[model samples]
Target chain A: MLSVAEIINLLNSIPVGYKSPEDNCFNAANQMYIPEYKKLGVITVANELQDNLPEADENDLFCDVPGCQIAFENSASYQAHFYNVHRYLCSVCRRCLPTAHLLCLHILECHDSYFIIRAKRGDAMYSCFLGECKVKLPTPKQRREHCINKHKFPANYRFEQLCGKPYKRHTKKPSKSVEANEIVDDMDVVADIPNMK
Target chain B: MEVDPDEPKTSPSTSRSPTQHIRDRNRQVAQQHREEQRAKTIDTVRFGLGEVQEEVEELDELSEQDINGLITRITRRKHASAEEMHKLSEAFLQSMDNIKLFFEAPGALQVIVKEIIGLDSGCQVGALECLCNLSLGEAPVCEKIIHQGGRNLVQCLDSPDERLKRTSLWIIANTISTSPKAAQTVVQMNIVPKLFYIYLDDSGEKNIANEFREDAAVCLQILVMGKNRAARQEDITFIKDNMIKKCRNSVAAEYHLKIIFHADIVNPRNEFNIEQTHHLMDFILGNLYTTPDFGSIANRLRIVYAIRVLSNMVQCVPTTTIDAMRQQLRGVWETHLEVLLNKVFDFGEDLLSLEVVYLIRNLIHDKSPQPLPCQLDRLEVPNIDYEKLLPQEWK
Candidate 1:
């Protein structure tokens, strides 16, 4: 995983190729090799690190689904995990996504109604922009459509952001532009700031 | 379900000889009755509190006004006595109203937090006690402490002072018990695993290094004493009805069906995310039965809160999580069966015994018991008389 610069810097810690080892240097004071430790220890460590790190082949990838612990041989196998095992059903929507990538995107674009509106269904419900909506929709797609068509919300009118990002996990970028009604300008704290006419 | 005399008359028993047959019937009926009684009372085992009672930590009492007066005095004074601080700290848990009063005061929390880091052992212990008691039964105060990076409170667990370490862990544990939000926060700070590791480190010279003359595992055990009283309906409604205005997640929200059940509207980010919910499930699955051997009264009290917190958590879980957890639940279910087999039969504490039923009932839904991270085949066949214990409608 070390970049070219990192490798060079690590190599530079070896005193043999350059000059005498620094007196107070960490590499000089303590390293695995006592025989020319500054040079040998650093080189040995770098070699061991490279050798020990699992290459991006057999065991490099894993299924990121919360509980599925199987590792993959390659990216193709990793992608196959979704189709083979994980059903990719959103808890709210109940629609099955074809792939893990699409599943992530579907949750982002659809699941919005965050409140348990009435006694019609279960005691509690899920929502995206939790308290803002009056009536809660059961599915993510319905909630997203409700926000845009019923509420007359702009295409890119985000329900909310968490930790400066959109409410849900980011998967792929939107295929089409989510045109905002108006530009948000330089202000960062959107909650406190009033809408500009 | 309706039994008829005709059915009994038609049976082979009517045609059989009397004495040996009568004895066999009596034996069968008696065994059946005994089995039914055992099944009905298994989870409801309540140990005699006096018999298994461990020492509850003592806190010198303080009045409601005395709490505020003490804080104000601490803030105003350049130096304070250890005795006075300890008394004040003990007094903090005495009243929820006073905790609210102290928190509502500006800079009081920061001042008390500063005292925790001071050189004076009395002030440190007192401040830690106040902080710990502040966590008991008060969600808002717990949230405040959790929000302020847990007041660097978790770091105090590493303190050489045993009183300081115990109090710190207790405070953190108490905070987690207040709400899922508080638990999520402390767990995120990456202390949940630390507690597990602390419990694991019971051998070697390191044991002698511990200052409390207490067991190394006690801090972790105390941390999971479960949800504070605030989550209880009576306590929650009492607070809601008495207050002049409704909190965003108060009783009104429950009626209205709000998503962020534990979040304040003004500060919405404080609620648990799905990942945090996963973390809670993970924590419970792994640590729920970490208490010392069963039948220990102290251990019984510890798991009550642990299971209660789990009950509160799964209340918010969606169906998908249940599906995902189904496979991993087998191991947890095995542990649950193991614990129940060992400790629960003689479980005599009323609260502990009662909470077990609540825990089991909460796990079941409709006809199918969801993957509750536990399995119970002992009571699979229904023989107990529900009508005897339950109401007419429940029956």
Candidate 2:
């Protein structure tokens, strides 16, 4: 990730003058603070360096599916795998790929169930962001709208669709492992109920 | 015209006096006697007939210099004086005869012909006239013109006066008619842009009859039809907005429609791309039947031709890009297909009519789930509703 000073140096390299130094500084800061830099490059570096972390050797690679040994070539390849295997979407058209920018825009602008869709499409199984709805929406838009409209927590809701997931500010969000077991139990009950009927 | 009386009158010898007939007979007998002797002494007199013929043939093979010399003499004496002008006019007329003579003997004056022809403004017209003549025949002059700074002729296109512009274009059109390479050269020089500029700036200024405007438009119409990609994108844009729109909207003449269709065929939009030509064709196909009034017969025919050329060109383009475009323009195709069909058949035996059929046939035939045309199985029906076409789902 680029530092604020490095970003400032980049901005200074440009020939045009900004209205004020404060505005330039803020813009430069915002540009450097992308989720890709934080999650993919910076945080991993920090975690690995802090204690010579045990998981440092495993950090360089990711397999398409859990327990599968085939290594993904890059982030884009991993993203493509999620799309091709799980969602069956067109990459260029942004059919069902979650991280695809154009598709995300389409979901946010056009769809009504953006929040539930987003959480369901994430790597982990989780409870609904809204207090009332338990339905798994496919995208971030559904999750966001559900939190704002259903929960009515305007101030606490953070709807940064690019990187940040919609989370309730006051709640202790359950980890993926716990949520996964809960999801399995719920699926079992639904399956059992269907048989009983 | 003055008739010279110094020449012999045309009549039978029998009408003349017997004395005159006797003298003519005696002269013929004496000429025969001399010919018989000359024929008998073949070894002495005719020793080099074959060699002389060969040498003459060789000289005839290289007579371009002689022609240039004749032309130079005329140009040097500028014909500033009335007597000189008359003499020069006489030489010019004689040069016409000389042109006929030298042109027949191959290679006579072939080398410096372009330079000689291009020598002066006065001589350029004559040179152009000769070029036009050479083009009309199967003379190798067109090849020479192309290689010998032929595109330099386009410098004449800059005339501010409408008549000169019209004439230069006419000359270019004539010169290019017999030479595809010449036509290609004209296109490479960006003649379309210059002609478009002239058409827009001069068309309505003088209240010239639609006849004159049509003539000017015809020049532009041909230049656009030439499909010159060497033309700058900015010129293409200007032509699309100003010249094309003006032609479509103008009440002065239907000939302007030819200009619009031709311009559309070449650039389609101001922006340059391979698809720009296809888009223009698609636009015309859409507009031809959709417009409330289809304009005149010539204009309609031109529009049909544009469609045909566009469709032919489309077949050569990559399937993937066309498919993407088809998906993008599904609405355009659906709404306009019927209208295009109604008028597409008007072009008979022309490729443009066939192109229209292909466009319509492909549109109706392509049956992809996605709105675009693809290499996959053809669609029997395309579902195009503008409202439902927007992105409906996201994940």
DockQ of the candidate models in sequence: 0.01, 0.00
Model 2, runs deviating above 4 Å: A1-197, B1-139, B143-152, B180-192, B199-202, B205-247, B250-287, B290-297, B309-340, B343-356, B367-395
Model 1 lDDT, residue A139, Cα: 44
What tens-digit string does per-residue lDDT give for candidate 1 at B1-395? 87885354433655667775666556544654454334323311111112111223332356777777776776677444555555544444345565577778776676766666554444565566656656654677778876653625755654444556655765665666555677655544445344433433333332322322132223333333233311333322322232222222221111111111221111212234445444444534433445444444334323443444444443334343354344335545444433542254333333343334434444544433344544444422222222243323323
* TM of each candidate vs. truth: 0.32, 0.33
Fnat per model, in the order given?
0.00, 0.00
Q: What lDDT is reached at residue B204 by model 1?
A: 38
Q: Write the per-residue lDDT of candidate 2 for residues A1-197, one digit (tens) a residue.
A: 23344333432332221112112222322232211110000000111122222222332335544334444423333433443233423333223322233233434333424433443456322334421234445444455565445433243323432121222346456687866443222221110000000
> How many residue pairs of model 2 clash at the backbone?
29
How many clashes does the backbone of model 1 have? 13
User: Model 1, B115: alpha-carbon shift in Å?
Assistant: 1.9
